[model samples]
Target: MDKERIIHRICALHETCPGNIVTEKEAISPELIGLNIFGEPLVGFASATDELFEAFKNSDIVGPWFLSPTEWLPEAKTVISLFFPYTEAVKSANRKATTHPAAEWLHGRIEGQAYLLKLIESLKKWFDDNDIKTCVPITDQRFEVVVAGNNFKQYSCVTADTFSSNWSERHVAYIAGLGTFGLSKGLITEKGMAGRFISIIVSKELAADPRPYTGIYDHCNRCGACVKRCPAQAISLAEGKDHNLCGAWLSKMGNLFKPRYGCGLCQTGVPCESAIPRKRRT
Candidate 1:
C-alpha cells in the first residue's frame, strides 16, 4: 500500500478505536473513564536495509541483541514506526501532579500501551489480508527485555550492562525518521516527547522517509526543563538520564499504584512536552 493509504488507515483507526479511550473499567477514577489516551499518531518509514539498523548492532547502541528489520522479517522491505502522542487531558493532568502520576496519565501509560498493541495487530492483519508479510518484534515470541543485572549477554552483545532490550521502539523510530532522543532519553518528535512508540517490519516495499536531521539529539534543545521536572532527580544536564535511578523510582511507584504505575513528570509542563522547543531568544 502507498504511504498515504497507510497513514490514512492509521489515522482512522486512532480516531475510532475503543481502546484509545479510557473505559470506566480501566480508569482509576470516574473522571478518567472517557478520557482520550492518545492524540493523532505520527508515522515514519525506513528502508529495511538502512545502515543505521546495522549500526544498532554495536555495543553502545542496542548491542547485538538488537534485531534489524531483516532479522525480524527476512524479506522486510520497510520498517514502519509510529509515535502516538498523549492527549492534552493526560498531559495536563500529569502537569498538575509534581511527584505521583495523575490518574489520566496512569491510564495513558497502561491503556495507551494496550491501544498501541491493538493498533499494531490491526495493521499487521491489514498487511496479511493484502498478501503482504509483516512482523512486530515486540509482540513476537522471540522478543526479550532484561531489566536488571548483567545477564543481557545471552540476549545481547552487552556483557556488563544492567539494562537492555532486544528491540527498542525509540531507536527504531529514530531510524525511521520519527524523531531524536531528548535529555530524558525520550524520543522528541514534532509533536513532542510525551508519547509512546511502536514499530513493525513488513515485506511490502515502501519508500523510506528522508531523515530531516543527522545527529541523534538534534531535536533536543537541552533546556534542562526535564531535569527540574523529574521527581526522581534521574535527569541532569551534565549526565543526561540515569536509568537506574529512574527504574528504582518506577518500582516504588509500582508498589503504590500496583497494576498501573508510571511517573511522567519529566514529560509534562516542560518546554519539550508538546512540541520541539523553539530556540531560546538571544
Candidate 2:
C-alpha cells in the first residue's frame, strides 16, 4: 500500500518471524541458538528511473552487467531498499573476534541470509495478494553473481573482475538515500555498516527519499578504524579496499569454517560500526 503501511508490515513480520531467530536445531553452538541476527530495518525508496542507475553501468562502476530496476521488472516504478542492521548480540560477538569470524557472525552470514530471503518472499506474497506487482531481484531467475575464482561464462554476462553481482544491494541502497559508502566499501547508513542490504522493485509509485549528502563516501569520516580492524589487510587509507585480497581471505575462511565462513572484521570495530562517523578535521 503506502510507505507507512509497508514499513509497518515489515517491522511486524520481523518482530514475529521465527526465521529471524536462530533456532536450536540450526545453531552451530548452544549460545547461538536464541540469537537474533537483525534489528529493526531501515527502509528507503528511489524512483525506478533514477539516472544514477544508468551511471552505475559505467565500466569503472558496476560495469555493463549491472541491471537497473526497470531491467529487472519492466513495469517497475519504485525501488524499496532495506537495511537490516545486525543485532547488538551479533555485532558485539564479532567485535571480540580478531583473525577469524566469530561463531555468531558466521550464523549471521549464513542463517541470517536465509531469513532475509524468507522475509522478502513473505513481503512479495503480501503485495501479490494486494494486486501489486513486485520483484525481488536477488531471488529472480535472472540474478547473476560472479564470485572470485569462479567461472562466469556459465552466465550470459561475463566480466574479468569477479566479486560482483548484476543486482548490488549496496548500490541500490545508495540510490534510495539509505546511505553512502565508507572507505571499506561498505555502505554506512544511519544504523551503520555492520548489516545486510536487500531490495525489491515494485509497480507501485512511491515518493523517492532525498539523499542528505552529495558524495558517494559522504557518510565516511575517513577515520581509518576499519584499516586497523581488517585482519585480511584488504583495506587501507590510500587504496581503500582490494576486493581480490578480500575475496581470497574469505575463501580461506571458507576452508576453515566450511559452510559458514565470513570475515566482517572491517565492519565490527570501525568508527561507523553502529552509526555514521563524524568527519575528522584535516
Candidate 3:
C-alpha cells in the first residue's frame, strides 16, 4: 500500500481502537474512565538504506550494538515511524505534578504503551494480509533494553551497553524525519516532545520523508524548561540529561507506584510540550 493508505489505516484504527480508551477497571480515578491516551499520530517513512541508520552505530550515537533496518528484516525497504502525542488530559495532569508522577500520567505510560503495541500488531497484520513482510523490532525476540543497575540478561541480538538498546525507537523516529532532539534529550517533533514513539521495518518501498532541518537539536530551542521541571534534577543546560540520575528517580517511582511508574515532568509545562518551540528573541 502507498503511504497515504497506510497512514489512513493507522489513523482510522486509532480512532476506533477500544484499547485507546481507559476502561473503568484500568483507570486510576473515576474521571479517567474515558481518558484517551493519545491524540492523532504523526507518521513518517525512511528508506531502509538511510545513512543515518549507519551513523547511529557510532560509539557516540546509539553505539555498535544498534541494529540497522536490514538486520531486523533482511528484505526491508522502508522504516515506518509513528509518534503518538499524549492527549491533553494526560499532559495536563502531569503539568501540575511535582515530586511524584500523576496518576493520569502513570496510566498513560503503562496503559498507553500497551495501546501502542496493540496498534503496531494491527498494522503488522495489515501488512501481512497485503503480502508485505514487516518486522516490529520492539516486539521481536531480539529486542533488548539494557538498563544500568538492573539484573541483566544476555540476548542474541546484541550485547548492548547499559542504558541502551539494540533498536532505539526515538533514534529510528529521528531518521524517519519525524523530529529532532531537545536539550532534555527527548525527541521534539512538530507535535512536540511530549509523546511516545514506535517504529517498524517493512518490505514495501516507500519514499522517505524529507528531514526539515540539518542539526540533530534543531527543534530544541534550548529553553531549559525541562531542567527546572525535573524533580530528580536529572537535566541541565550545560550537560543535558543524565540517564543515570533519571533512572534512579524512576527506580524510586517504581517502588512507590509498583505496577505503574513514570515521570513526564520534562515533557509538560514547557514551551515544547505540544509544539516545537520558537527560538528565543535575541
Candidate 4:
C-alpha cells in the first residue's frame, strides 16, 4: 500500500492520533528512531514462549508486518510506534491527597487495562483484515508472564526485556515517537504516566511517524516532585532510575493495599499532571 493510505488508515483509527506527517524511510537521519521488539525470546510464562509470541501475530497492535521478538526483522521496512496514554485513568482513580501505600501503588492508574486489551484486539483485527503482520509490544506484563512459572530463573531467558547496552529496551519506543523520555523511569505522553504503556511496533506497512514526537524529549520540569513524594524513597537525585528499590517494594507489598497494584509514586506527581484536564465529560 502507498504510504499515504497506510498512514491515513492508522490516523483514522485514533481520533487523537494527529494524523501522519513526515515519511521515515526517505531520510534515515542519525536521529532516526525505531522500535526494538527483540527482547528475551523465551522470557515469558513457562515454555509457552512460542505460544505467547503467536498471540501478537496477525494482530493490529499496530497495523503491521513481521514481529521480531529477539531482534528487528530485516524485512520490516516501516515501524509504527503505537502509543496509548493513561492520564484519564490516573486522574479518575487517584483522588486522594496523601500518597498510596506501596502495595496500593499504580492504583489510580490502569483502570483502562481492559479497555486497552479490547483496543489492541480491535486494532489487531483491523490489521489482519488488511493483511498486515503485527508484533508484541511487551512491558512489565512479560516479566510476570515468566515469573508466574514454577522455574523461571533456571531457564536461559531473562526476567524481563533487557537488551544489550540499552538495558531494558526503554529507549526503543520513546525514540520511535511512542512517547517522550521521562525522568521517572519510562515515557510520558499527553495521557500522563500512570501505568504500563505498550509500544505497538508496526512494520512492512507504508506510513510515517507523526512528527515533533520524533525528535523530542518530554521536558521534565526537574521539580523532582515525584522523588519527594515517593514513600519508598526509591527515586535517587543522582541516578535517573532505581530498579532495586522499585522492584523490591512492589514485591513485598503483594496485593495487601487498596487497589492492589504496583507502586505509582514515580508517576503520581500531584502537580505535574495538573496541566492535563480532569475529565472528558462525554
Candidate 5:
C-alpha cells in the first residue's frame, strides 16, 4: 500500500477506536471518561537497509541488543514508525501537578499504551491482508528489556546505568525521520516530546523519507525547561537524563497510584511540550 493509504487508515483508526477514549471503567473521574488519549499520529518510513540501523548496534547507541529491521523480519524492506502525541487534556492536567502525575496523565500512560498496542496490531493485520509480511519487534516474543542490576546473565553486556531494550521505539523513530532527542531524552517531533512511539517492519518497500537534519540533537534548543520541570531532578543540561533516577521515581509513583503509575512532569509545562521550541532570537 502507498504511504498516503497507510496514513489514512491509521488516522481513521485513531478517530474511531474505542480504546482511544478513556472509558468510565478506566477513567479517574466522571469528567475524564471520554477524554481523548492521543492526537493525530505522525508517521515516517525508513529503508530496512538504512546504515543508521546498523550503527545502532554500537555500545553508545542501543548496544548489541538492538535489532535491525532485517533481524526482526528477514525480508523486511521498510520500517514504519509512528509518534502519537497526547491530547491537550492529558498534557494540561499533568502541567497542573508539579510533583505527582495527574490521574489523566496516568491513564494516558497506561490506557494510552493499551491503545497503541491495538493500533500496532491493526496495522500488522492490514499488512497481512495485503499479503505483506510484517513484525512488531517490541511485541514479538523475542523482545526483552533488561533494567540495571537485573540478574539477566544473557544481557550482561548491557550496562546497569541506562535503560536498555532489544528494540527502542524512539531510536527507530529517529532512523525513520520522525524526530531528534531532547534534553530529557524524549523524542522531540514537530508535534513535540509528549507522546508515545510504535513501529513495525514490513516486507513492503516504500520510498524512505529524507531525514531533514543531521546530528541526533538537531531539533532540540537546549532550553533546559525539562530540567526544571522534572520532579525527580533526573534531567540536567550538564548531564542530560538519568534513567535510573527517573525509574525510581516512577516506581515510587506506582506505590501511590498503584496499577497506573507515571510522572511526565518533564514532558508538560515545558517549551518542548507541544511543539519544537524556537531557537534563540539573537
Candidate 6:
C-alpha cells in the first residue's frame, strides 16, 4: 500500500477499534514499552545467543549503542517505531474508559488482550495488503523465545513485542521521535510517559524511518521528577539503571492492587505523569 493509504487504514482501525486511544500513533507505543518493560531478552536479539531464551534472562551480554543488536539484523533497511498511549495516556489525559472495566494494560488484567490482537490483525492485514515484508514476533514461540526462562510469566507474542529487535525501547522510541527521556529513564511522551505505550514496525522498503511524530525534546531538559521519586535508587546520575532494583520495586507495588492483575509501581498514582501538566485536550 502507498504510505498515505497505509496510514489511512491504521486510522480507520483507530476510528472503529475496540480499545481506547484507537489512533495508529497512540496504539503502537506499548510494543516499545513492552520491549522496554522486558529489556533483558531484547539485548539478546542483537547478540547471537546459543540459548536465545537464556540470554534474555541475563543483561551481561548487552553492549553499548546496540553494536551487537545492529550486527544481528543483516536484512533491514529502515525501522518505523510506533507509539500507543493506551491507558497511561488515557489516565494522564484524564480520559475515562468509555465502558465498564478499564481497558488499560497496567492493571495487569488480560481483559484487553483479545481486542489488542484483533487490532494487530487489522494492522498485519494492512501490511500484507501493502506488500510490506515484516518480521516481528509471530506464533506463541516468538514471545516464548523471550520469556521462556520465567516459569511464572506467560503472555502471547501478539500481546506485545510487535516487530521487536534487541535494542532498548527508549532508544527505539527516541529514534522514532515519539517521546523524550525522563530522569526515571522512561520515554516521556506528550502523554507525559504515564499514558504512553510503544510499538515498533520495521520495513525493508520504507527507506527512512518516519520523522518522530512528537518532534524535538524541549521541557524534558528541565525536569527530573522521575529522578526525585525513584525509590529503588536504580536510576543513575547518567544512564545505567539497575533493572533488578527497578523490577523489585515495581514488584513491591504489585501486591497492593487487587485488580485482575497486580500493581504497577511507577504506573500507579503516577506523580511523574501528573507533573507534566496537561496538554490541551483536543
**Candidate topping lDDT:** 2
Candidate 5 runs further than 4 Å off: 148-160
TM-score of each predicted structure versus truth: 0.94, 0.94, 0.94, 0.55, 0.94, 0.54
Q: List model 5 lDDT by residue over 105-190, tens digit each.
A: 99999999999999889888888999999999989998998553432232122335656888888878888898888878788899
Model 2 compared with the native: what TM-score? 0.94
User: How far is 193's C-alpha from truth in model 2 (Å)?
Assistant: 0.5
Badly placed stretches (over 4 Å) of model 3 are 147-162
The 10-residue segment with the lowest total lDDT in model 5: 150-159
Score residue 229 of candidate 4 by CA lDDT: 63
Compare candidates 2 and 4 on TM-score and give the better one: 2
| Alpha-carbon deviation at 200 in model 5, angstroms | 0.9
lDDT score at residue 245, model 1, on the 0-100 scale: 84
Query: What lDDT does candidate 5 reach at residue 191?
Result: 95
Residue-level lDDT tens digits of model 6 in 170-273: 54455544555544545655555553333334343443333344433332443333444455665554643445566555556455433333222333344445
lDDT (Cα, tens digit) per residue for candidate 4, span 169-276: 233444344445454555554545554434343444443444244333344555566777666776655654455566666666545443345556556654444232
| Candidate 3 local lDDT, 102-218, one digit each (tens) | 898998899999999999999999999999999999999999875533222221111223477789888888888999888777889999988899998999999999999888788
The regions of model 6 sitting more than 4 angstroms off are 19-75, 87-105, 108-117, 138-167, 196-204, 207-219, 228-241, 256-282
- Each model's number of backbone clashes? 0, 0, 0, 8, 0, 20
Question: RMSD in angstroms, all models?
Answer: 3.1, 3.9, 4.2, 15.2, 3.4, 11.4
Which 10-residue span in candidate 4 carries the lowest summed lDDT?
37-46
lDDT of 2 at 186: 88
* Predictions in order: lDDT: 0.85, 0.87, 0.86, 0.40, 0.86, 0.39
* Model 1 misplaced regions, further than 4 Å: 147-161
